[model samples]
Target: MRILAISHLFPDLKEKRYGIFVARQLSEIHRLGAEISVIVPRVWCPGLLRHTERWKNYDHKCPLCRFEGIEAFSMPYLRLPGNFYNRWSGLAAFRAMKSKALELHKSRKFDVIYATDFFPDGDAAARLAKYLKLPAACLSIGVDVNITAHSSGIIYRHFIKTAKALDGTLACGQSVADRIKAVTGKSPLCVYGVLDLEEFSPAPDKIPARKELSLPPDKTIALYAGYLTKRKGVYELVEAIYRVQKKCQDLLLVMCGAGPEETALRRLIREKGMEHTVHMAGEIEPERMNKWMQASDLFVLASNTEGMPNVVMEAMACGLPVVATAVGGLPGAIGDCDGAILVQPENVDNLEKAIVKVINDNQLRADMRIAARKRAEEQFGVKRNAILILNYLRKIVEEKKAKQKG
Candidate 1:
């Protein structure tokens, strides 16, 4: 089957970790024998006054730049002035896809179109599918629905409309799927993000790995790897870590990832006198993430909201126990695995208690570590998820063909 994949958040040469999960999924789908072409629409700044120092920092090889096997396109806009408008600008992507689709259609027939959520990408894909009379599917991955809904009123509504318009929709977790249904009255298939089991497997030399990362030698390391934002419950994590430190002085919290909230989180750590206990290692590469996960004793996610977190799966794949808030599809992702501990959302006391348990009980920690890796391999392995997505796409394509024939 021929497929057109559109995604705004896809990783580029500059930042390979950005929206990498989407790219990985597409690559896996390609490996499953689908002839896939990726379309990434980017903005081109034309005005001089609008181009500020800030614009200089924007990655040039972003969505516009071509990857190994994917087709990319860009459209000109009024630089800085266009920033605000460009976000909700479905027209830019629509025009790009329209031009590319025409070219692709002449030589190749596409069975389906798959689009990732957030920005105007999904709407553009839906529009293109409608124009070409092809089935379209939209995939939602956490922040696409949650952050967008809270940030942009116009885009949020468009997201709901786009969700309804698509032939099928897929979400990372049940909570996200339910949110889509609640907003658009359309149920989306829940497809949790996957982990590469082979790559994320537990490292034999944990002490060496920890030393390589420059982590604490004596303390029991609790790692949090992801965006350092307020909504991620970073503040609550600090508070929980502080509480844990009071009882267990030998405990350490290692936070990895960078965001606008870094300064604020750092301030909190200092104010709470957690300087000795909490270590902030900002924005490590995706390749190095697994090493940190394997080196750490437990992975903690104190997010207020989430879909199925990719990091949690990765940590589990590395044979590290997970202690995350029970929100979104987290409970489902962890299942009944003793390797993972779930606490109430935004509950600092509960989070601290769970962390303390993991730190104190050596036998339980060992069991959880083993269980976490096994569960990840069984459920969230990349190969397994790839097959599920391929089968789903094939079914949709067949149904569309049958409908046309009838």
Candidate 2:
């Protein structure tokens, strides 16, 4: 099967870790004998900011780029901040890439159009497919459906319309699939994100990993790896860490990833006097994440919502116990994952208690560590899940072809 996957979610020259999951998934699908091409839409910025060093990295080289040997392109589209005019952004994305989409279609004759996220990515994908007369499938990663459904407006209606119009929809978790049903009255294929077990496996010795990263080998470290946004509940994490520090001085809270909430998180850490206790490592490359996970004793995600967070699973694959909020598809994803713990969403008191428990109990930690790795190997194998998606996409392509002939 040949697919033209369009989204702004794929990794670019700037943020290599942005949508590494999507990149990994497509690579696995390629290994399964599927041909995939990508068109990552870059959010257009003004001239002043566009020429800056940081913005330069954000800019993708037009025409062609390569991700894991898969052919990919970057298209620029006008976007209004805060996602206010998302519908407009979808139109902008389609208009920007319409010619290129046609050019690729004329040459390779794609069987279907695939999108990473629903709102703009899927919206644009659906439009492109409609224009080129091909089937379209969208992956409903948590936020694209859930966060938009909170209000009933043009954006919400547009999101529903996009989902309904798609030829197929897939979700990272059941909760996200359910939310898609609630909004668009359509069911989506539910599956977890892919993880490279080989890359993320637990280190044979934690002390050596710690030594490589220069992390304190003696201290109990709880790692948080993901975007630093309000939605991620990083503020709540700092608050819980403040309380945890009062109780256990030797414990450390390390946050990784960069986002809009960086300044706010830094201010909160300083205000709470968690200078030494809480550390922000900023953004680390995806290749180096395994060492960071191995260097830590456990993982914590105080997210307000998520589909099935890749970080949680990656940490589990590294044999670190996870303490995350019970929201979105997390409950289902964490199902029987022994080292994973769930606390109420946005509840700092509960989050604090859970973190304290995981850190203080040594025997429990060891058991959880072993259980976590075992769970990942047994349940979340990347190659296996990638084949599932590939088969489903192929099925859709065949069904579309059959209907056309009929």
Candidate 3:
């Protein structure tokens, strides 16, 4: 089956770690026997705060920028005068994508058009599909829904209309799916997140990895990897770490990722005298992330809201136990397996207790490690996930053809 995949969240050379999950999913779908083409909408601006001019220069030399086994195209966009007016910005993106998609449709016929996110791209894809008389599906990953509910007037109306128009919609987690259904009055397919098992595996030598990263050899390491945002509950995780450290002196916390909250987090750590206890590793490369996960004893995410976190899967793939708040699709992803210990969302006391439980009990930790690997191999493996997506695309294509004949 021929499929067109649209996503604006894909990673570039400068931001190699961004939206890697989307790239990985497309790669897996390709391996499953579907002919897939990717369209990544890239908005170019000079600075984060300033929008000067739009440039269309494509960077073809970066291997990391390219998705494997798929023909890819990029639609360069420029943010208009005011980004605060998201409706105007979104409309501009839609126009840019519509033009490129129409041009591509002239030469290549696709069975289905699949777009990611609920805004600009999904809306654009739906419009393009309507114009071309093709089925369109939107795969939402979280922020799209949040933005829609938070926005007003035209943007909210556009999001609702776009969701209603799509042939089918897929959500990363059940919570997201429920929200979509609530808004659109249509149930969305719930596709759990997956990870590359081969790329993320138990480290051959944990001690060596820890040494290479200069992590303390004796202390039990707890890791938090992702955007350090206020909503991510990083501050709560720090407090929990502090509580755990009081009981277990041989404890260390490593936080990896960069965001606006970094400065505030660092300040909190210093003010609370957790300088030696908690270490901020900043942003690390995706390839090197496995080393950090492997070196750690347990993976922890204190997020109050999430779709389906890819970091948790990566942690599980490394045979590390997870302690994450029960929120979004996290409970579904973690299951009730020995691999994970789920606590109530935003509860620092419960988080502290869970972390201490894993640290203190050697047998439990070992059991969790075994179970974590098994779960990763069985449920969240990239190969299995890719094949499922590919098969779904093929089925959709066949259905479309049958409809035409009838």
Candidate 4:
């Protein structure tokens, strides 16, 4: 089957880590016999922001490029931040990519239009599919339901229209699927993200991985990777790490990723005198995540909202137990995996307790490690997930074809 994968969050020359999960899934789906092409819409910034470093890096990006053997194209679209601009931005993106998508559809004979996220991608896909007379499918990764639909804005209504228009819809977790039902009164398939078992595996020698990554070998390391913003509960994570440090001096909290709250987080670390205990290992390449996961004793994320986080699955595939807040699709993602423990969001005391428990108990840690790997193999492998999504896509295409004949 041939598909045109439309996603605005996909990785481009400027941001390689952006929407890497989407990239990874497409690669595996391609391997599973689906011919896929990608359309990544580049957002336009106005005035001084256009000349800023953020926009400058993307200024000279090639219109088309091959990302991991798959043909991908980037098109320019006008966009603005926040919910106020959601509808306009989505329309702008659709207008920008419509011509290219139509041309590609004629040449490649795509079977369907598949969008990776709801807002701009799914919304635009709905518009494009109507124009081209093809089936459209959209998958909710996180933000569309957790942030966009929940907001008291016109985007909430826009989301319903887009959801209802799509021929098929998918959510990364049951919580997201539930939100989709509430918004559009349509049931969406819950398809979890893929875990690359080969890439993320237990370290044969933890000390060696620590040595390579420059992490302290003598300490019990806990890792937190993602944006360093309040919404990610970075502030709470810092406080929890500090409290845990008081009881276990040998414990170290390793943070990977950068965001707006870097200054505040650093200040909090200094105020609590946790400079030595909390190591800020800013953004690293996606390829190097396994090293951090393998080197760490456990993983922890105190995010306030999420949609089946790929990091949790990555940690599990690496055989590292997790201590994450019970929010979004986390409960569904972790499931009955004894390798991880869940706690309430924004609770530093509870977060600290879970972290300390995972750290102090060697037997539990060992059992968790085994369970984590077992769970990844059973339900989260990339191949299995690709097959599930591909089968569903095929069913949608066949049904559409049958209707056309009828």
70 Cα displacement, candidate 2 (Å): 0.9
Off by over 4 Å in 3: 44-64, 78-90, 150-157, 181-187
Task: Tell me each candidate's TM-score.
Answer: 0.88, 0.94, 0.89, 0.95
lDDT of each: 0.78, 0.85, 0.81, 0.85
Candidate 4 lDDT over 1-406, as tens digits, reads 9999998767655455678888888889999888998888877655567576445444425443345647888787877556777766668889999999999999999999999888789999999999899999999997778887767667788888889989999998888898888877878888875778999988877999999999899999999999877889998888898889888899999999887788888888899889899999988788898999999999999999888888888998999989999988888877567988999998899999999999889999999999988888887888888898898899889988999999
RMSD of each: 3.3, 2.4, 3.5, 2.0
Best by lDDT: 4
Candidates ranked by TM-score: 4, 2, 3, 1
- lDDT score of residue 176 within candidate 1: 78
TM-score of 4: 0.95
Q: lDDT of model 2 at residue 62?
A: 33
- TM-score, candidate 3, is 0.89
| Candidate of highest TM-score | 4
Between 3 and 4, whose TM-score is larger? 4
lDDT of 2 by residue, 1-406 (tens): 8889897877765677878888888888888888888888887776677577445444544333256648888888877655677767788899999999999999998998989887678989989988999999999788777775444588887887888888889988888888787766767788885899999999888899888888888888999999998889998998899999888889988898999788978887788778899889989988899999999999999999887889988999999999999887888878557788899988999999998998888898899999999888876778978888888888888888898899
Per-residue lDDT value at 338 in model 3: 85
Angstrom error at residue 9, model 4? 1.7
lDDT per residue for candidate 3 within 185-297, as digits (tens), equals: 97887776558788799986689999999998898999999998887999999999999999999999999998778998999999999999999999898889999999999
Per-residue lDDT tens digits for candidate 1, residues 152-197, read: 6666667777777877878887777888889777677778665778
